[model samples]
Target: MDVQQPLALLGGLSPAQFMRRHWHKKPLLVRQAIPGFKPTVGRAALFELAGREEVESRFIQHKEGQWLLRHGPLARRSLPSLTTPEWTVLVQGVDLHDDATHALMQQFRFVPEARLDDLMISFASDGGGVGPHFDSYDVFLLQAHGKRRWRIGRQKNLALREGLPLKILASFEPEEEYVLEPGDMLYLPPRWAHDGIAEGACMTYSIGFRSPNRAGLAHEVLLRLADAAVDEEASPIYRDPGQQAVAGPGAIPAELQDFARQAVQHALQQPLALECALGEALTEPKPNVWFEPAEAAGMLESVVLDRRTCMMYDDQHVFINGESYLASGPDAALMRRLADERRLMPGDLAKASDDALELLSSWCESGWAHAGLSG
Candidate 1:
């Protein structure tokens, strides 16, 4: 995407301008984020996806001053009738199941693929809502069908109501309100309290981002580092020559404390370990994701990554599906292009080395990518 060029998705704000002015700091309400947007997946089709075991789904209902929630592979019969008031069915990771949804998600590729998560579809009946809740990640709620009434606030007190199945705000004080029609969208920053209620039967598509917490990131990085450390170092267990007994048997020994600190230092000191860990972590697919191995894609001319494939690269390495490979020279450039654009033209691979071509063929056979997909 041309970051400097105006995009209707950003309300006529160029990507660079939008990022500079509003990204992660405030809300952006675009009147027509996608003009004349017709939903690719209809109500019946979405319900079909909700029935699949691999798809993550949820049902929420507010009936007679009570909030109720349920998990799914929900059968169609289990869902409330279309005429029923105050009920919703949310299907997560819709992009994984529908090709058009995946294509829809690509329009937001102005953001880094590493941070861009999946699109979720929420279908609701009249008066339906998940309640006043704040998310831990940024989100763009795009109204796909019918209408929704939204109330937003910059709340400081992040308290939840008692004995509720969902995390609902105890005292929601809305500062602004809007009724969104089809094609309208609202972007909210992380922890920005907001509520959306269906004015009638409506469908909304949520484009969300992945924000890794500091401690959680540290844990993942350390795990990756440990795997590297085990392969590179095989140190003997500690043994003290000078006999010393501690008065407090429960307390850890001073020698052990020093050992622990040194171990951490050694892990951090490994060359390029942190970079490798981060690349691998960012490209790792979600737990529920699975890929079917492809039979030989014979005589490939060009290729495209499967929608489910997660590929990324750094200065020294290319990472995919929790695996990493050293990449350099012209081959590195070729692979990086594949990661970024997600497709390679015949000309793009004209100069690739035999080693690189063989590797790509292996990827195609493994179902990570498709062969002869270039137009």
Candidate 2:
């Protein structure tokens, strides 16, 4: 994508301009983000995805002014009739299941792939909605079919209604409203509360970004670091030779606390250990994602990483699907290109070191990559 060139998706603003002006700062309502947009996945196809065991989905219904929610692996028969009013079926990660959906997501690669999460589709009958709620991450809500009336606010009161499966705003104070038609889009920042209700039967595509909370992200990184540390060193267990009587057995000892801190410090101290752990954590595949191993190696004239595979690299390491490898020299450059472009030509691989070529082959064998013309 040329940052200098204006985009129809961002209402004639360049990706750089959109990122600088509206990203994470305010809302943007593009009149026709995708002109004459049609859903890549139809209603029937979305229902099929909701039925798949590996896909994440949800069913919500609002009847007689009451809100209800359900988890899915829902069958077509289980879903409410198309004529049913005030019901919705939402499927998460549609990009993972459909090629067209995946391609649609790629258009938004102006955002770093690490932050770019999944593309979800929400289908609704008349007046259907999940209720007024705020997300912890940024999102682009693109209307695909029919129309949706959206009520949004910069919610100051984040309290939720108690005793509900869904985290609905107890006191929703909508500051703005709009009726979005097909091809229209709304961009929202984290914690900008919004509620979208179907004017009639409608489909909306949500392009969401992951904003990992500081503490939760720190915990995951530390766990990965600890795993790497264990493989690198066999530290001795603490032995209390001069035992001191404890006043309370329930209390954690100061010595044990220090040992825990030291353990984390040691992991952080290792050269590139923190970087390795972070890259691995960011590139880790979703728990439900699984790939079948390749039966035999094929031609390697060109190669592309599988859509389900996650690949990323830093200055010293390349990470793919939760594993990390040290890379340097020309091999490092080659691997970085693979990570960026997600495809490598025959000539590109010809310049790779023996170690890098072997690694790419192994990735193919593991079903993380395939040898052929990339889509």
Candidate 3:
């Protein structure tokens, strides 16, 4: 993708320009961002997905001037009548399960894949909404079906209503409002408070970005570093015969303190530990996700990566789903192509050496990738 090339999705601004001028700085409302767009999952299909154990879903109902929310594993009987208004069912991470939703998500690859989260779909009746709230991460709210009236602003009052399951803003101040039609989109940065109400029946797709908190990142990285450190056979101890202890018996010795600091430094000194940890942390599956291994050996002529598989690369290693492998030569080039393109075409896979083919077949059997047959 050309960052400098103007895209209709960005209201004709180049991705570079959009990032510089709009991303996280403010909100952008793009009309017809996806022209003639339709929902990837129909209402019935969405309801079906909501019933599955693997999917996370919620139902919100506003009736008789009261608000109610329910967590799902919902049966069709649990839902409101089709003719009823002011109800909604929201499904998170649709892209991980549905191929069409996954394909739709790829259109936003101009954004770094590592930061990209997943597509969340909301199906609502008239007046249905989760309520006024702000997200800590950036989001692109695309109107996939019908219409939604949105009121958004840069809110200062972050106070929330007490005793509610949802974190709803108690005092909302809107500076802008828009009724988004099908294909229209609104991009909002973190802490930009917003609310959307279904004008009638509506479906919205939120393409959210991940923003890992500093402390959370440190925790994950340190855990990974410690795991790596445990694997090292040599356990060096502090040696300072010339050093004198502090006067207080309770005080820690300076030499031992230095040794502890040095240990931490040494753990971080491993050449690619940080990089490996980052890839692994980002690719860590949500608690409920599980993969079943495939028995078939993948075709040498072509292969396609699984949607849940995360593949990334650095100078000396290729990382996939929290595992890293040293990469070099022709095989490295081929694997890097697979990471970038998300699939190996027949021609591209044909270029792989026999050893590369064997490695790819192993990956397929492990459920990381699948055979892509030739026409």
Scored by CA lDDT, what does every candidate get?
0.90, 0.90, 0.88
- For each candidate in turn, the TM-score is 0.96, 0.94, 0.91
Write down the TM-score for model 2: 0.94
lDDT tens string, model 2, 1-375?
688789999999999999999999999999999999999999999999999999999999988877788898989899888889999999999997887898899889898888999999999999899999999999999999999999999999999999887899999999999999999999999999999999989999999999998998999899998777778757868767766898888898788888888887887998888888899899999988988788556546778888888888999998999999988899999998898778899899879877777788889889999876333
**What tens digits encode model 1's per-residue C-alpha lDDT throughout 29-93?**
99998999999799999999999899999999999999999999988999999999999999999
TM-score of 3: 0.91
Model 3 misplacement above 4 A:
63-66, 237-259, 373-375
Q: Which one wins by lDDT: 2 or 3?
A: 2
Taking the tens digit of each residue's C-alpha lDDT, what string does model 3 give over 246-348?
Answer: 6788877877888899999998988988888777777777775666799867356678888888788878888887777888998999999898889998788
lDDT of candidate 3 at residue 219, scale 0 to 100: 94
**Model 1 spans with C-alpha error above 4 angstroms:** 245-250, 373-375
Per-candidate clashes come to 0, 0, 0
Task: TM-score winner between 2 and 3, please give it.
Answer: 2
